[model samples]
Target: MVLTDTHTHLYYETDAEKQDLLFQRCFENKVNRLFLPNVDVSSIAKIDALVEKYPDNCFAMAGLHPCDVKEDYEILLKEIYQSMAGKKIYAIGEIGIDLYWDKSTLDIQQTAFREQIKWAKAAKLPIVIHCREAFDEVFEILEEEKADDLRGILHCFTGNLEQANHAIALGFYLGIGGVVTYKKAGLDEVLSHISLDNLVLETDSPYLAPVPFRGKPNESSYLVYIAQKVADIYHISIEEVAAITTANSKKIFNV
Candidate 1:
């Protein structure tokens, strides 16, 4: 069963030894493809290096994260726009309004989000969103920016059935991650009404580890656990989950 981690920050680990070991475990578990989302200018080098090292396994995205949106966000956005020129970025993402960390930056965050959405559409690529306690804001922008060419994943989706359907209606796939394994997350129920075709698997690794490994650093290798949990929730085989989600990933990334 080949599994795809549609969203993961492999650049979070700087140690070569740890990186090697983590990737080795991922390979062993059939978690072959790891999509790395750009946080900011500082993370670009690490992300580029990882994609260079594992050209076949790692894919890179170019975008300014919402949390990283500060007063001087225009400068960062300019850099992001320049980086996207003639470069092989798989998506424009991990971008959206993150109200949890700093509500003060909401205005700029929405501006960044809309601009990045324009970038994604211009590049004719998919977007990977990172919405945190700003579903209404995110959905409003998506509604305004809705178009035939606009499509992507709602990364780390933990919303209710209505939200799930809304995202699906807006041409997005729900990114199912380690949160689904949480005891009281209720994601299992929310997922029950959704179809596998509109879902993708992810780890958001180095964070949000599954049940057995919760509170610890998450890894791509732990994707199997998330897949197993998803399989259980859908009453489908883990292999089926892997196959469907992997196909969904390939469809979005065109890889």
Candidate 2:
């Protein structure tokens, strides 16, 4: 029952003092191996600090978030590269097209996504993608970039089966989150066609908390609930889902 949360924002307003209790709870539930994704320049310091504090438990990735892409993107991207320079960034991520908030940055977002993909290839690190209401746009950039040397996970995947298949075809893993536990999410249909080998479990903590605590701030300890729901959906034991997805995560992040 060792569950690995492949994606989470552990550095998101999470205090270092509370980390001990958080680790205790997660370890008690066999949830370890947390990966942190950097949103923008503002997050780089905090993310680095967290990783430094828990190098064994928390791993980090560096990239500019899509929502942060704007006129000042060039300056921010330079800062991102500076932070990642000579550092072992687990991935280039939380990066992709996000049309939900601001569509004005569509062109810049696409450029940033492609640039990050190039960096991922050069750095030889997997990417943790963030896509929302922009699958076609994201997929279009990914295809044009031809990221053959790049591979990663689609964090908080809300796409249909066809999108999942396309991502898989491009050597990416689907990141299943608390949304899957929602009865109305329609994730079960996508899960039916996605094998466990191509899936990884995540909580995206402080965000998508699973059912029974659906509206509360999420924690890594709640990853068990997400795993349980996935197991129930696939008609498999919780332990099986934990082991398989943990292995899948390790295989990708090389942890």
Candidate 3:
């Protein structure tokens, strides 16, 4: 069973030994493909290097993350946009409003999100949205920019059914991750109403690790646990979850 981790930060690992072990674990778990999202200018080199080294397994995306948005975001975004030229980026992502960290940068974050959406449309690529504590803000921007050509995933979706339906209605897939395994997350109820075709799996790792490994550093290898949780939620088999979500990832990333 081939599994795809639609969002992971393998580039964040600095230790060669641990990185190799992580990749080995991922392969052992049949989580072969990993899509790495860009955070800011500092992440470019590491992202590029990871993709270059594991050209077959790793793919890179270019975008300024919402949390990274600052007063001089214009300059940072310019460099990110320029780097996308003739590059092998899968999407313009991990971008959106992030009020959780700093609400002061909301204006700049929205501007960056709008601009990056334009870039994604111009490049004919999917976008991996990173919405956090700003679904309304993100929806507003998406409403203005929505079109038949626009497509992407709402990475790490943890919203109510109304918001979930809204995102699906906009021709975007909901990216399910480790949070689904949490008992009180209420994601299972949300998943019960959403179709499997409109869903995709992600780890958002070295971040949201599944239960049993919760609060620990996450990895792509743990995607199986998330998939299992999704299967249970849907009353389906883990194999079916793997097949469907992998297909969904391919549909979005075109990889």
Candidate 4:
């Protein structure tokens, strides 16, 4: 069964040996497909190099993360957009409002989010959103910017059923990750009501590791654990979960 980690920061591992080990572990777990999200200008080349090194496994995306938005965000956006000049990007994202980190940057964050949505629309690409403690803010923008091509993944979704339906209505896949494995997270219950068709799997790695490795640094390989948890939620085989979620990822990334 082939699995895909639709949103991961594996490029953060600059150590060559450690990167090889991580990819090896992912291969062993059948998590061979991975997509990298750009957080800031610094992450662009790292993501590019990783994709270049493993062209068959890793893919790239460009966007300024909500938390990274600042006074000079427009300049940052220009730089990020320029980085896509000769690159094959699967999405214009990992972008959206993030109220968890800093409430002060909400305005700029919203601006960045909308701008990136426009970028995606113009390029005919899907977006991979990063929403944290700002569902209303994120939804407001998504609703305003709704269009036939404004579709993507709501990365790291930990919302309730109503919100899930809201996102689905707005054309997005709920990206399930490690949070679903935490007994107290309640994401499993929410996901049980969500169809596999509107869902995708991700690790968001180097963060949110699943149970058996909870509280530890996450990796794409542990995507298997997240996949297994989803399998249990729906009483389906892990292979079925892999096939469905990986297919969902392919639908979004067109890979």
Candidate 5:
């Protein structure tokens, strides 16, 4: 079975030997595809290097993460937007409003999010969103920017069934991650009512590790745990989850 991690930060692992082992574990687990989303300007090079090293398995995206938005963000964001000039990218994200970290930056975050959305729309690329405790805020912007071609994955989605449906209505696939395996995350319950067609799998790794590795650093190899949890929810085999979600990833990333 070929599994796909629709969103991951595995490129953050810089050691050559260690990064190889990480890819080994991912491949050994049948997690054959990984999409890397740049969190800030600095991550562009890291992501480019990894994708260049593993062109067959890794894809890259560019965007300034909401949490990274700050005063003087316009200048930095311009740099990020321009960084996409010579590189090939599948999306313009991990961008969206994140109210959990700092409500103070909400205004700038929204502006950054909208500008990135414009970038994606102009490029005709899908957007991988990074919504966190700001569904209402994010949805408002998405609603405003909603267009026939406005489609992508909502990375690391942890919302209720209503929000899931709302996102689907707005032309987005909900990105299910390690949180689905958490006992109290309620994501599994939410997935019970959402079809595989409207869903995709992710690890968001080096973060949100699944059970058995919940409190530890996450990696793409652990995507199986999240897939298994999703399989259990949908009453299907892990292979089916892999097949469907990987297909969903290809539909989103065109890879």
Candidate 6:
């Protein structure tokens, strides 16, 4: 039963010193692959270093996070493109609109999102999207940019069934994470209409830890709890969930 954490921020300053111990814990728990998504230009070097440290176990994606979008976004976008020119990035990720924090840069966020979508299409890499309270805004850009060639995952997905179906129709997989285990989280509604094949497990750690570890710092090993929650929601075995989602991750990331 090999579990793959399709999205995480192991490169964050908080996790810098715990890499070896984290990998050891994940190894013990049968968590084989850890996909790290870049936050912005500032964290690119740190992310590359982390990937270099555990090249086999850790893979990386390059992109400008939505929240990082500002007036000078073009400069950052150029940096993102140059950084990924010939790199082995698994996805052009952690990108999309995030209105939860500040709506002031909504315009810039949308522009950055569309531009990165073009980047993803040109690079032939899947995208890892991050949408907050801006589902409508995110979908609007996706509808405009998502052609027959564009595809990716909706990282940290928390939308309703309609949004889930909309994303799936465009050939994107739903990135299930720790939020699914929340007591009142209505993610099961979305899961009820979506099949496991179109679903992939993630932790988005060290951020959204699952129940029992909820409110605590999350790690790759905690993905097992997420897998268990998914199995319960889908009414299947944990091994089956792990197998299918791991395969889904590989299929999208081409790992």
Q: Which prediction has the highest lDDT against the true structure?
A: 1
lDDT of each: 0.94, 0.89, 0.93, 0.93, 0.92, 0.88
Give the per-residue lDDT digits (tens) of candidate 3, residues 8-80: 9988899999999999999999999999999999898899989888999999999999999998899999998
Expressed as tens digits, the lDDT of each residue in 1-255 for candidate 4 is 999999999998889999999999999999999999999999999998998899999999999988889998999999999999987999988899888889999988988999899999999999989999999999999989999988999999999999999999999999999999999989888887889999999999999999999999999999999999999999999999999988888888889
State which candidate, 1 or 6, has the greater lDDT: 1
Q: Is candidate 1 or candidate 5 better by lDDT?
A: 1
Q: Which residue segments of model 3 deviate by more than 4 Å?
A: none
Give candidate 5 misplaced runs (Cα > 4 Å): none
Candidate 1 ranges with C-alpha deviation above 4 Å: none
| Least accurate 10 contiguous residues by lDDT in model 1 | 79-88
Candidate 6 C-alpha lDDT tens digits along 1-255: 999999988676445457778878888988999998988897788878878878888888988998889888899989978988666898998899998999999988988888888888987889999999998998888887868778889999988998899889989999999999998999987798889999998999889899989999898899999999999988999999999999999999898
Over the full model, what C-alpha lDDT does candidate 5 score relative to the true structure? 0.92
Q: Pick out the ten consecutive residues of candidate 6 with the lowest summed lDDT.
A: 10-19
TM-scores, all models, native as reference: 0.99, 0.96, 0.98, 0.99, 0.98, 0.96
Question: Model 1: clashing residue pairs?
Answer: none
Q: Model 4 misses residue 89 by how many Å?
A: 0.3
Model 4 scores a TM of 0.99
Model 4, global lDDT: 0.93
RMSD per candidate (Å) reads 0.7, 1.2, 0.8, 0.7, 0.8, 1.3
lDDT of 1: 0.94
